[model samples]
Target: MNFRRFKIGYRTLKTAVGASIAMLIAMFLNLDYYSSAFILTVLCIQPTKRKSVRAVYSRIIASIIGVGFAFVFFEGISYHPLVFGLILILFIPTLVSLKFQDGFVSSVVILLHLFDSKELTWSLLWNEAQLMAVGFGVALLVNIYMPSIEKDLKSFRLEIESLYSKIFHEIAFYLRNGDSDWDGKELVEASEVIEKGKALAYQDVENHLNRRQNLYYLYFDMREQQFEIIERVLPKITALPVNISHCYIVADFMEELADHVHSGNTANKFISKLDEVKEEFAKMPLPKDHENFLAMAALYQFIEEMDQYLHIKRSFVGFNMKKKTASKES
Candidate 1:
């Protein structure tokens, strides 16, 4: 296998091995009560450096809440199976909706099992909490020693870059060859990738919510805005009566523009292409009627705005800043 592919496989193996070792150690200590909680809390959490810590916090909090509820109920009622069943009905759904509900549920069950005993008291709660701490500590080891956030983010960025390249290629083909069929397919495919990209990017943000400098959130939000702008342009571009050659040329320009943006660089090629497209519009023979002129004018307007969006992207990381300048112009 290639180097990158081998690294991915190696990482997966390392994670599996680490988690297995953790499981065995927990089991040997008879800490099965917290085994599920540890895995679920850590697994559902995004694989970020921060989440390793937050997962511990969330698990601990949820455990306390669950055990607290169990203790209250058990103290109030005797250990009747029917009462336990009823409590289950009420508590299960409530726990499931919680952010770290999986861990909480396990904790509540442990509490219920130990309920109504004379041994039940703050001391027992402390003991359970300590065991949970051990489990959480184990999970943290896996996260720290076998972290994959850097690898995950790099992979995600590569996928986005690849998709951007394909989108530009499709656009170019349509513009240069006037191949409506291929351009249509390309646009559809690119849209699908954009949807997928948005989902992945959002996941990246959620994984890092507890971190201090969450640049992933900013990057994801920026991509979302760009997705919106492109969506608006796709239909307009498709509807234009121009031949495949014009479409491909425009697409080629867009591809180059997208590359510049992806690299976080200025879109000089995009600006030049915008002017070229404008000249094309101006030189085209007109129907000499008001509505036709209006339609042509609208097309130019869209292109100009799209160009402005690209320019704004070149200047900063978000639409919020661009809005200020647009307001100033008005």
Candidate 2:
């Protein structure tokens, strides 16, 4: 058996522990329908702390509202089957209107308890409230310490940068030699890495209640934008009709850019070097034939795209600062 494939994730472990604790506490309190606490804990456990907190809050509020509806319909009117069905019709909408739909299942559980007991006594209400507190409270407590995904985020960042480096190097090689055996696998790999990185970064953002933005997320987003530009210009670079002096110039710049593909903010210097290349290209004589003219145009468009790519990196504020902070932390 491949036990490695069955490796439990942190969130799963937390959910299990939380559910166990919630059930034990509910049982200790002698709450009726104590097993429901286990279900509540499982339902309330979320991947991110903010989500878990929100889930708990919603479930608590929804349970309270459920109790209220039960009191009005069952106690004031009658605990008949028609009244039960009617209460559900109105209860669901009320929870939805209050934005507590996440708690619908847990609230329904409470309603079932009331229906089973066939009573709206004060003791039963207190028992249900205690169950909610134990279940959701345990879930909230368990989720308070979300394991940091910083290491995974950093690994993805490094993988993306390495892939980008290889891609740029391949482009430079093709531009210089007018032929490359490169299979362009790095392009696809980089795309996948960027997508995964963005997802992980977004999860990190959700992990923190107060954090509005994650720097790693912004970094991946910037890289995604740059990757699009790279994809756009790749065919243009490869399909140049003739290898000219300007192509070599751009190739050399690309090699230099490849070497500097770290999490640093050095795009400004490259942009300056690129401008020099542009000036050099301008001084060359006009292309002598249509093929050469098309080649020159393609090279020019490639340079413009490279400029956009560098500008995207430059516009990513605080990237270098975050890099430094990460370095110090390491």
Candidate 3:
């Protein structure tokens, strides 16, 4: 059985439960057009808490404006087809201007209720308001306890770190041996991991209303910037016409870096070591031929790129410190 394909997601389960509860409550209260509550519940349910709350507020305001328009168009003029169409034309633009376009469908539902009645009364208005309250209220309650994606975010972090480590190791191997049979799969995999991590991190940000920034999101952003440097250096490293004595030193440094791939800020130490490498390169004998000269130039550029990569990591030191301080205070 391919039950995996048929598996219901949390959002789906929430929508069904919330809609049912809303409809039941409306029916219990003997509200007119009780089924409309189900529609609102289904519409109001959103993937994140902030979105759900925003949907509720938008719908409530739009529905109120819709009722006002209904009163003016239906009662003030007449309950006719032309008047209904006129209300839609004016109402849609008004909602769009107010940035309540998300609530258009809910407002239309309210308009239809008035259209069907042929007349607006206090009792009917109260019934629709209660329906909105029941439906949107149930949606809000169901969405209050969103399942945390912390575990998924953590998994992505570990995967990105692992891919980065593999990439660094491969670069080191190429530098040391002057050639490799490597298919460059790690570069592609690391890019994909960082992208996926960023998406999940952004989703995590959307799930929390109070969160102005997510540490995981910032971490993925930093990695993405670092990955771009890695991509630029890979070709430069591989295209070297000849490997100099300095290549082995750089390879050793890369190997140490690969082994220490972690979430901590240790890039300053590597930056110091890189400065020492640069001094050693300056002291070494000049390239003997144009080919060796080109190779040394490429290696120098590679070193510059590596410096930029480490600097990117180093920049996160202040960010992490602030995050730690906030954590302790909280």
lDDT of 1 at 134: 56
Instruction: Summarize candidate 2's per-residue lDDT along 47-148 as a digit string, tens digits.
Output: 898888888888888888988899899888988889989998999999889899998999989999998898778898889888888888999899889778
Structure candidate 3, residue pairs in collision: none
The candidates, ranked best first by TM-score, are: 3, 2, 1
- CA RMSD, predictions in order: 7.0, 3.1, 3.3
Instruction: Tell how far residue 217 is off in model 3, in angstroms.
Output: 0.4
TM-score of each: 0.63, 0.92, 0.92
For residues 191-309, could you state the per-residue lDDT of candidate 3 as single tens digits? 88888888888877878899977888888888889889988999999899887888898898888888877755377778888899899999999999999999899989998998998
**In model 2, which range of ten residues has the least summed lDDT?**
321-330
Q: Cα lDDT of model 1 overall? A: 0.55
Ranking by lDDT: 2, 3, 1
| Candidate 2 collision pairs | none
Q: Give per-residue CA lDDT, model 1, range 1-330, as digits (tens).
A: 555543555435545655566556656766535454345433523355465676667666766666655656666775666766766676666666776664554455455546544346666665575556555665666555433355555455455556655655555555456454653454455455546555654545444545433344444445456657766765565555544233444565666655654543445556667888878866768746665555465466567767766665554443235444321100
Enumerate residue pairs that collide in model 1: 171-251, 174-248, 175-245, 175-247, 175-248, 175-249, 176-248, 176-249, 178-244, 178-245
